[model samples]
Target: MMTKHELRREYLDRRRALTDIEVQESSLQIANKVLELDIWSFSNYHVFLPIQKQKEINTQYLLHILQGKDKNIVVSKSNFEDISMSHYLLTDQTKLRINSHGIPEPDQNGIPIDEKNIDVVFVPLVIADRFGNRVGYGKGFYDRFLKKCRPDVIKIGLSMFEPLESKIDMHVNDVGLNYILYGEEVIDLG
Candidate 1:
């Protein structure tokens, strides 16, 4: 099995090789697959926005579907100072601005949502394994953030690529995903 560092570079390279059109089409497919899941039953959800450069899954269409269902859609911004993320309610009027890392972060003025109230979180990842182990950019932000959520909160990962056949390097502090959606499938690891 490749180490987390090696897998990050390899997966990132593969993601970057995709053309803009391919990214759009694949993202649409992944989004459609997500809609097939029973995740909509949850009234409150936390979604991570796409970082175009990182080739993250485009969640705009998914966000619209969630909004149409009257679900409380929430977004998060990195608190660089604390190295932890804070969740905020995303609304029709929520203004978004790109952060230094090129991620579209919600405005700080958004109403905060307590961690316990979130039913599910659509996670971001650089790579994930069949065992649900995930490797992000090594910031440990999501690891810290997920720890605060309720024990049964469903943690889902949105990946443009499928899970690695082998397990990823998992540490005690790393938080594994319960489900990972990639291409046209949602692999439930829970």
Candidate 2:
């Protein structure tokens, strides 16, 4: 099993190899693909955008404008400059954060939902397999969060590179992505 430190190193190295243009192009493509889905035709979908990194569309801008006109959107609480692999829900008023791990008591202000209400979710990952298994930042935040989400919730993995051959040590609780979007292509895991 690769140690957390080693995995971190490898992930960072691969992620850093991506150029600024590559990242932007990948993100734009992923955003475009998301907009094409018919699911957004009638229902209100909550989009969590990352804060901009070096003028790139970070979560904030992504959530703010990606849905285009006449769409419902919400932004999560800014814990830091970047949001990690966690899940948040949108309410009629605003977006609320949830504790993926039950260990830390969730904030009372967290928006409550029956998971089934969520239609789609976009998850970030350091690396992903062709099978859609993802490796996160060793926090298991997305894994735990997926457990509580509806099985039908479209889980899309966002990354800077194409699928790698490396095997990710996944626990039984680890969640698989339905699709993965990279700079040049989108792989449907379905």
Candidate 3:
């Protein structure tokens, strides 16, 4: 088995090879397509913006609509890479921070979560399988968070590439995605 360090390195290397223009164009296209979907138009959604060096999407624009700030504006927070959870209420001002391990802990004011209110959640992944299994940074933060969330919550995995057919070792606690969105396609995991 590869060490965690090696796995991380390989993941980072592959991610870094993607150029800025390519990442931007692909992410924008995917985000646009998602917005055009009926599900996005009809539901309350929470999206997690990626950190630097990872594929960056135009989350701020989406946030504006969800937060009711402006239809055409995109808002992003500072100190994003250091912020835990990177969790902010799409409908409120509250932010939840995530630690280095990817575990989200409510901030001092507590995370304002409306369990039944959330319709969709966009997640980040290093890699994913056709079976809906995702290999995150290996920290299990998203996995743990998903466990505490409502089962009906739509779990969407956002990736820059298509799903890999190879087996990715997953534990029992690992969360499965309901949908996987890639630059090339959007797959329904149901």
Candidate 4:
């Protein structure tokens, strides 16, 4: 099995190799797939803004769709000092600033959204396996934040490519996803 570090490097290069047009189109496809889900059933949603440098799935498209539906679009603010992440409602007036890692995060300390209120979480990943195990940049930010979420909250990973057939090197601290929105398909691990 490939290690998480190896998978991260391998998939990050593949993502970076895609043309801008391909990225946008693939992102749209994945976004459209999730739109057909029972998304409206969830009132509060947690989502991530894209990191342009990595060419991640443009979840901005997903966010807009969720926004128009009047779902509570929640983004995050990462604090390296505490090795923790805080969730906030993304609004038109909320300022988004790119961090040192290039991930767009909400700037102002807006009202913190409670974990219990979040019914769904849209995760960004470097790659994932069919079993819903995934690799990000090796930062445990999402993993730590997710552990605190309600046990029944749906955690969905959005990826530009299909999942590898093999399982990932999952750690005890890692949080498994319930579904992966991969390359225009919604894969349910359960």
Candidate 5:
């Protein structure tokens, strides 16, 4: 099995190889597949916006769906120093700006929302296994964030590619996912 570092590189390279149109189409397909999930009943939903430079799955399509459903959307601002993220309630009045790391996030003026209120999280990952273990940028951002949430919270990983067939070596602090949403596919680990 490949190490998380290697998996990150491989998946990131695959993402970088995607053309702009391919990215758009795949992201839309994944977003459409999300509708098939039974998770819409949840109220407060946390989502990660794409880091364009990293070729992450564009979450705009998913955001539109959340808006249509009138879900209380929550976004995060990262603190690199501690590899932690601060949650904020995303609203029409919330101002967003790209951080130095290329992540689009809300400004400090955004109203804070605690992790306990989140019922679902649309996780960002490079790849995941059918067992729901995911590999991200190795920063432990999502792992730490998910750990702060209620144990029953649904964690869904969004990817442009399908999950890896091999099991990933999970760290002690790693948080597993409940579902993985890829292009026109969903792996329900629950």
Candidate 6:
């Protein structure tokens, strides 16, 4: 089995190789797949804005869906110093700017939403396995952020490709995802 580091590098290369059209189309498909989930009854939904340069999933489509559903959307601003993220409510007046790392974040803090209030989180990842083990950018930002959320918080990973047949390495501190959305498939890990 490939290590998490190896899987991260491999999947990063694969994602970078995707064309812009592929990314957008796959992201839309994944977003549509999310509709099948029973998570719509939640209020505060935390989602990650994609890192465009890395060819990550275009979460803009998913954001549109959330907006249409009238759910309270929450986005995060990352603190590189502590490797932690501060959650904020994304409002119509919230201005977004790309940070130094190419992540689109709120230019200024909006309504602060505590992690415990988040009912569902749309997590970003390089790749994930059948068991919901994910390989991200090695930042541990989401793991740390998710750790602080309520134990019942729904954690969903968005991916373009299907999960790997083999499980990736897992750490004691790593938080597993509840489900993974890829293409038109939803892999339920719970």
- Over the stretch 38-157, how does candidate 4's per-residue lDDT look in tens digits? 757778999888889889888878888987889899989888887788889988889888999897988766878987789999998999888989898887999998888999989999
Q: Against the unseen true structure, what C-alpha lDDT does each candidate score?
A: 0.88, 0.58, 0.62, 0.88, 0.92, 0.92
Candidate 3: what lDDT? 0.62
For all predicted structures, in order, the TM-scores are: 0.96, 0.67, 0.71, 0.96, 0.98, 0.98
Error of 3 at 32 (Å): 2.4
Task: Write model 2 residue lDDT over 1-190, tens digit each, in one string.
Answer: 6753576678767666767776676777666665544456434344544423322223433454444545544223322224333333444554343433312222446564444465666776777778888877666656665676677778878776667766666778779998887666778878
Query: Which residue pairs does candidate 4 place in steric collision?
Result: none
Candidate 1 runs further than 4 Å off: none
**With candidate 2 superimposed using the best TM-score fit, by how many Å does residue 8's alpha carbon deviate from the native?**
3.5
lDDT for model 4, please. Answer: 0.88
Per-residue lDDT tens digits for candidate 3, residues 1-190, read 4543454567667778888877777777677656644464435566666665454444554555555633221112323354223333433454545545343333545344554455677777877778788877766767766665678878878777777776566778788998887777777878
Error of 2 at 153 (Å): 0.9
| lDDT per residue (tens digit) for residues 13-69 in model 5 | 998999989989989999999999998888999999999988888899999999999
Error of 5 at 90 (Å): 0.8
Per residue, candidate 6 scores C-alpha lDDT tens digits across 1-190 of: 7888888889899998999999989999998999999998899999899999999999888889999999999999999999999989999999999999999998655889999999999999999989998999998999999999999999999987899888788999999999999996999888
Lowest summed lDDT across 10 adjacent residues in model 2 is found at 97-106
The C-alpha RMSD of each candidate to the native structure, in angstroms, is: 1.1, 6.1, 5.5, 1.1, 0.8, 0.8
Clashing pairs in 3: 60-74, 60-75, 61-74, 84-97, 84-98, 85-97, 85-98
Any runs in candidate 5 off by more than 4 Å, and if so which? Answer: none
How far out, in Å, is residue 55 in model 6? 0.6
lDDT of 1 by residue, 26-126 (tens): 87887788887877778998999999998888898788888788999989989788898888899878889999999899999999899889998999898
